[model samples]
Target: MSVTTTLRPPATNATAFVPSLGIALASAAAFGSSGPFAKSLLEAGWSPGAAVTARIGIAALVLLPVALVMLRGRWHLLRRNAGLLIAYGVVAVAAVQLAFFSAVQTLSVGVALLLEYLGVVLVVLWLWLRHGQRPRRWTVAGIALAVAGLVLVLDVLGGMRVDGVGVLWALGAAVGLAAYFVLSARDDTGLPPLVMATGGLVVGALALGVAGLVGVVPMTVTAADVDLAGLTLPWWVPVATLSLVAAAFAYASGVSATRPLGSKVAGFVGLTEVLFSLLFAWLLLGELPLPVQLLGGVLVVAGVVAVRYDELTAPREPDPAPSLTPEAPAPPR
Candidate 1:
């Protein structure tokens, strides 16, 4: 039930507003395509662990310099929030990626993604049950429609073969991703989004690196193992793109966007990522989503929209003021 929203700083300006919104949209697009990008690398022979390691590791390296520059004199913040930071890194960033990669190893990318969106439902459920907020009839109906769409998309009853283990991994990914949003919501303004992203990535990198060294997962650098067979480009192309553009830029921009959009609107607007991924796949990979999967994607969007609508239209309980001081106000969607 954990959901992290990006930490926001109080600010008001047309310039900041436009840029933050743009960045948020772009970040969502990058994140949405993460699955397809990772899938491509796997098809090109990269192990799921290796691909994820490369992604977070290189991204950490890229952001480290930026974080250090902006976060000067803030080592105390990092030290103080070390525990939460580690949770953000390991569970939210690393575990989600690893589980997603494993899921796609056995499930079609679309089906896996659809399953992962179940996290939105989990978020709604958490808000209802734990927060004691009653969900409206429309919200409940939206959830049912989304679930039905998933069944159609997955064709679960149509004898589509899927690995049980992979399904479990995807379900876990949903949980991790849901936790990520919740955790982000708690991020304080004193800790900038880039700084938080950097810390999390560093932790994720170190943990994955350790796992690799221990033979729990392979981290070999053999040229043969890094082969890129399906692609006409160099072996490092995907890795580089994934690390800098997809992971580093994507996460940084996403956190920045939260500053203006607030957590809830940002989450729902972020759903546009699925559409972006589908479009990207059509152009780059020549992959077309099935009819049901496309419909499912629409339903998923609808469900998130429902949540946003409920929050906006319904009377809301007063939120407890966040305990963490110096909270940044998230931006409007």
Candidate 2:
């Protein structure tokens, strides 16, 4: 099997540009809803592990047909990319959600999302260290600003305190999120985004199921009503929304967007999910952002912009063809 496959480069033409941006934004919006929806489930007595498992499991079933069609008898691709798919499932789908949902149990949705998005900075660091691609001055400045924003988000000096366990879980989510981007960027796999999304979700769901069976993480659910936007609703309402819109559409659109936007741009674009998460959290959970935290969010977005600008303007070198030796893999958003 080839270690590297030729991945699609970022789109530059107007025709491809507008649609990709639109899809990416839509993906962000869809994904943003997950935080509030999952929080509602948590309030209703659903364990983080159970909620995440159901979300991925349902999404996998929803996308299975499309993935199979895309395969078109190309079964060997799955075997060839088994490692990549497994990593995507374990880290991106299962672990990321487990950590994020655990954090949201104590942290507000927006703050939890902000923490997970620290993955963007981690991605930059990974590229710098692993690929030996030193960041330019703007990138360095961006990292500094992002770190400052993180401190304010945490409110380290303020009397207000976030749960220590929540902080740790959110940081774990950040690492998983970074893995998602790094894995998704590997274009040499010859695997379509839909296939990867489907496979990862299935694998992740199974892994979570096993964990639940063994009681590593509590798995619980309730049939009680859920509160959303000041309205009482059936439990199924949020679960359906989370599974279909948030997980299925979000992952599909996100993977497609990455193909045209490139992982770096796509990752930064995903920061919009934090803003949307804040809105949903306020509306659905009544958790509004603090003024200082909002300011910190602005700084975080600014930092991402600085880093993206540096990437866009930096001189480029032609990429060499990917080698066919087995090596590490990457993930999706």
Candidate 3:
């Protein structure tokens, strides 16, 4: 629709902080809930590939009308941003899910998750190396604490068994996760967040479906009922939640959060998804987390707070003064 959008510049201020944090947490909660629902589907004889593909496909269809409305009949918007759409879909959406699912086949969920969260470190490294956006000392400290907390939360030390192949796949997913934050935080892209989310899901769904047909991953599904939230419900309940709450709302809000929170801070906020997942599993499935895990959650929150504090307190580079327009005879002398 050629709707001009203005971007928030520089860093987050005190006034804008709450709204950004709220949206980020909302995204994390929505995304975290997907774990239990997806788990239930798997227990009900749905392959990981099938569950992911269906979730993405249905979410895309659900968001299509809204995305089109945002597009406002500006066909050129798609043409101009095709590369971004494809990359977001392929790397951030498809690759992340595919690789993580594949990794879990060999590795324990906790270990695989720890490895994938290495994407946080990778994000820091990428910014440092690629854009020279070196992390402040506090940012680095927060990252270390967050990762250490993750190890505790995931009980990675308790499961020292490793598979070489799964490590590689998880690392690949880490890259994909990094791509997600990097792509989402970009302000120069003309595409709206909802449009980008929808397009990425569509592309990811097609890619995974093709992989399934070629036998790269299993595509089996069953009509059996599943146990979730201690209730035996038809398989569709989890499926619907995964598509609507997890994929649609989660991705849209997650994408929008990056515009204000920036990539690094948003990644820090994303670490909370693990905490939310545990909370959901406990509430919905009656599985309580250990005391140590509760401690880990606190550390994770501390890490996020540390990063937010740094962003607000850090000194800003002063903006350059504007040049006077052709004031001195357009002097090129």
What lDDT is reached at residue 49 by model 1?
86
Put down candidate 3 lDDT per residue, 1-333, tens digits, no spaces: 122222344357667767878998999999999999999999999999999999999999999999998999787989987878888888899999999999999999999999998897887787778776678988888987898899889888887658999999999999999888878887777788888889899898989888988999799999999999878999999999999999999988988887778888888999999999999999998989999898888888888888878777777888998987756566576
lDDT for residue 277 in candidate 3, whole number 0-100 = 94
Clashes of each: 19, 6, 2
Candidate 2, TM-score vs. the true structure?
Answer: 0.83
TM-score of each: 0.79, 0.83, 0.93
Q: After superposition, how far is residue 232 of candidate 2 from its true place, in Å?
A: 1.8
Best by TM-score: 3
Overall lDDT per candidate, in order of appearance: 0.71, 0.79, 0.87
Query: Model 3: how far is 254 from its true place, Å?
Result: 0.6
Q: Which candidate, 1 or 2, would have the higher TM-score against the true structure?
A: 2
Model 1 regions lying over 4 Å from their true place: 1-22, 106-111, 148-159, 220-231, 259-264, 290-293, 316-333
RMSD for each model, in Å, please? Answer: 7.8, 8.1, 4.1
Q: For candidate 1, lDDT tens digit of each residue in 178-203?
A: 66665665546478888978888898
Model 2 pairs whose backbones collide: 5-188, 6-188, 7-187, 183-330, 183-331, 184-331
Looking at model 3, residue 86 earns an lDDT score of: 82
Per-residue accuracy of model 2 over 277-310 as CA lDDT, tens digit each: 7667777778877788687678767876786677
